[model samples]
Target: MTAVLPERVEVAIVGAGQAGLAASWHLVQRGVDHVVLERATAFHDWQDRRWDAFTLVTPNFQCRLPGFAYDGDDTQGFMTRAEVGAWLGRYRASFDPPLLEGVEVVGLTRAEDGFLLRTSAGELRAAQVVIATGGYHRPVVPPLGLRLPDGVVQVHSADYRNAGSLPEGAVLVVGSGQSGAQIAEDLHLAGRRVHLALGRAPRSARRYRGRDCIAWLEEMGVYDVTVQQHASGLAKRESTNHYMTGRAGGHDIDLRAFALEGMRLYGRLTDASDGVLRFAPTLAQYLDHADSVMESIKNDIDAHIARAGIQAPVEARYSPVWVPEEEPAALDLAAEGVTSVVWATGFRPDYRWVEVGVFDGTGHPTHRAGETDVPGLFFLGLPWLSTWGSGRFAGVARDAAHVAERLAARAGAPVPA
Candidate 1:
């Protein structure tokens, strides 16, 4: 049965994730009457999707929302998914943010004054709409054009938690990002013989006085660059790689090290048969590719430091974690009793529910911080919206404040308290 539709509201925000929550907090602080619609029962997606040993790459000190910060005493610490979820709950309580939970947004269409949002519950009309849903909504699996044999079990990283959840066998983890590396490490630790398909070797940070590389970026205003500044495309691409992985430290667990200890590193999977996985030679080439990228980043950082006349010592301390020198002559799958393949590739943004005509050529919504080309539409949680820091928890508040100010000005009201 179709539920009743609200005739009108001043603003309607979609997806109650971090971005949506941040936007609502700002809207309420400005006394802009708004309602947030979340499809889930709570902020359960990020919490539930994380693996058992997963933690934030960014430390807790940087995990602040608009009015609130992470309350824990550990400032130089990383927060687990559970801790992040708990903090989000506190953030929701602090503002009493008006959130309509379990209401999935199905479609959106342009209305005369603003937009009409159709949801699972019903319809909502609002003068302004903020699409604050994060980037990881859609999971991208390997483009295995050929059909796999029935004996092989395959699952995406989103559904994976631990080795126990995987089918019994030698496991092959595809992708080399934080998720893939961490999962490979965990499964190896659990006594499962593992194989990792290396895509790219990401530059890892060398710990300096027991702090992450991101802390330095925060201090250096690297995260403060915005689209308005006309930053180089290389700068934006490098920023994505820089923050994707964890650094080396006593607490740090290196995936390459884990692979050297037990797991086998293979190139891209070419094809698979009845329990047999084939690989290409590209894996060896990736090491050089990764090293060049890292070298470029190091040079860029050094140049930036020198140009800015900053005196802080810049250093690269950690060595690349060891991988096998040569590919194995033959990887015997039947001998090891391999059974499952976990695709830790990554996620893509799915905007099918978003029916508006604001996306760019690459299918990403084109916006300035949060303002869309369409006046009443806005976006949040996009990568490098204002600066490198704009997407992180520490950076989001400033963007939120900016969006709130713009919204108030559009409404012809003084900035809300």
Candidate 2:
């Protein structure tokens, strides 16, 4: 049910996802008056955008929303897409936040007093606004995709549902990020012939020594590493996440192993024309880079284990199970009976509706931990907004709290004791 839109509120939070809800929780605790505007139903992205077989890449324990942490028995286990949606539902019910569903904020402009939000409902004014819609706004596909044969179906990773939904034939998945790798695996397991185009995204071990790599990284303070403290500086924010999977109790996504199992691997998809696709001659180089990254992570873990004198089980290091002999530069898609293409290319931010000057040249919001130079505006649920986990369930609570505190201070609201 849609909540009645208020004419004015002390705070207006755009997007009722994890970050927005978390911020709302904090604001409620502080006895602040705020309304959360959601374009769709709460947690709609988790339920709609994800594929049927999708599961969390991170462990269940990491789903730490403000005042509500994952309390399930399988703390180390990954939640399926349904489970994630249910969890978020439980969080919302626990708080009964003042939220309006089906209200899209189309434009945001500075008001004489604070800010004016032009929404599907009507104009609402607030003294402060929290932009927590997240970074994945628009799905991106290359212009080369337009040149593909008309018979071939093309879908972005966001729109991909399952293998059975596509035409019966070989499938080509472009990109090797988490979604790409996992989607390819899903198709392969479903008895579909899979051909994957590899990107520069590195792979990582799911588990090492006595724990999940994520757990080890948490212990090593990897997730807590702030964007400013990161060695790569702000560039780390744009880095592709290492590929792994939490499907079937977590495992590594070895493209090499997939290749051995009859999944045709190719380098980056360069161009498409006349029912044919061209690939770069860098399959071996890309694979080696992925392996080296995985090994480098393991090396760090080994060093940490030695330094901490932790007597965990010693394990054999990974050796390449398969290698590319010759880099295939071209594929006749029509001849190979390739029926569909899954472009797991990633997304670009779209804040064109936001008239605020808080964004940088790249259109990413310019903020320090969600606080923009504009006093009444802030951004949240962005990758590396504060730390490695800033955008994930593990760290959004902290970031939301930070934003809520700032918002409260700006509004002259006293935090609860």
Candidate 3:
């Protein structure tokens, strides 16, 4: 049986995280009547799943939303998960964002007026819909085709809480991104023998060298480069550097250095049986090649600075920093008695519930800024929406503001102020 539908609004924003919140703020500033739908009770879904020690790789200054900034002494200090969540909560309260918490949007379809949105709470109609759900909602797990022995325990990085959550044995962390590296380091510190599967070492930024890389990218207009301008799809994808290194000097966790000290550096997990995980020995070699690519980028940046005669102290300091180009030594997990695997392979956005036809061959919506092929339908908080920083807390606001402006110009019935 169908439930009674509720009143309609000008716009319906989905997801109450940073992206959704920014959208709502922009709409409010534009004097557009709207409502926000959220599945969780509060913002930051990762907050519930983040381990106790987790902190954002991007500093708090880069974590600001539109109309507000992080009020703290240490602008470059990375905030813990709890601190971030609290800040988000405070932001929500300050703006009194029209957020309907605990409302799960089950379906979205075009309506005669605009769109009909079905949620767990009730049904509502809107002239336009903005899908602001970030990319981390779905966790990517290991491929099902890969056979694993019944004795081997596997958990996605989302399910991981702490080192104690692992089974009583040595641990194998698959993936070398920030999450994978952090988890591997944590497990090793917890007295568990850890083996990290090498995928590709990402290009890491030196966070503490006076000026943060994110700020530099913003100033240099790196994010403004469009996908169309790049020569190739691979070139476009490789343009941005996503890796973040620890800033606390020698004591900080360096996955590359840690791997060199004895953590296993298997290329990839092919198959596992009889409590044995098989790895490609060439994994370390590939990682070395990846590291060289990063070094080249850094060197290029330094060369450009020298040619431009930029004698700023920060620029001078940035030139001499060394990015290593070697993979860590491999350690045998079986010898150390580690017995579990954690897949931190990242996430993929699923839009099965979004019944729109704007998706491309890759199942992602094609858009400029946040505009979609389907009129009145838009998206925000995507990996790279408008600029390189578009998805970040600081970057999302401008994109959202642009989207709200477009929405205001549409010919729809005025929503009650």
What digit string (tens of lDDT, one per residue) describes model 3 on residues 156-189?
A: 8888889887789878888877678777877877
**How many residue pairs clash in each candidate at the backbone level?**
5, 0, 8
* Models, CA RMSD each: 3.3, 1.0, 4.2
Task: Report lDDT per candidate.
Answer: 0.73, 0.92, 0.71
Task: Give the true-structure RMSD of model 1.
Answer: 3.3
- For residues 34-84, write the lDDT of model 1, one tens digit per residue: 888888755677666888767777877788888899899877777777777
Model 3, 397: alpha-carbon shift in Å?
1.4
lDDT tens digits by residue: candidate 2, 1-417: 545789999999999999999999999999899999999898799977899999999999888999999978999999999999889999999989999999999999999999999999999999999999999999999999999988899999999999988999999999999999999999999999999999999999999987999998889988899999999988888999999999999999988998999999999899887988999998999999999999999999999999999999999999999989899999999889999999999999999989889878898888889888897899989999999989689799999989998888987897667
Best by lDDT: 2
**Model 3, TM vs. native:** 0.86
Give the range where candidate 2 is weakest over 10 consecutive residues by summed lDDT. Answer: 1-10
Quote each prediction's TM-score.
0.88, 0.98, 0.86
Candidate ranking (TM-score, best to worst): 2, 1, 3
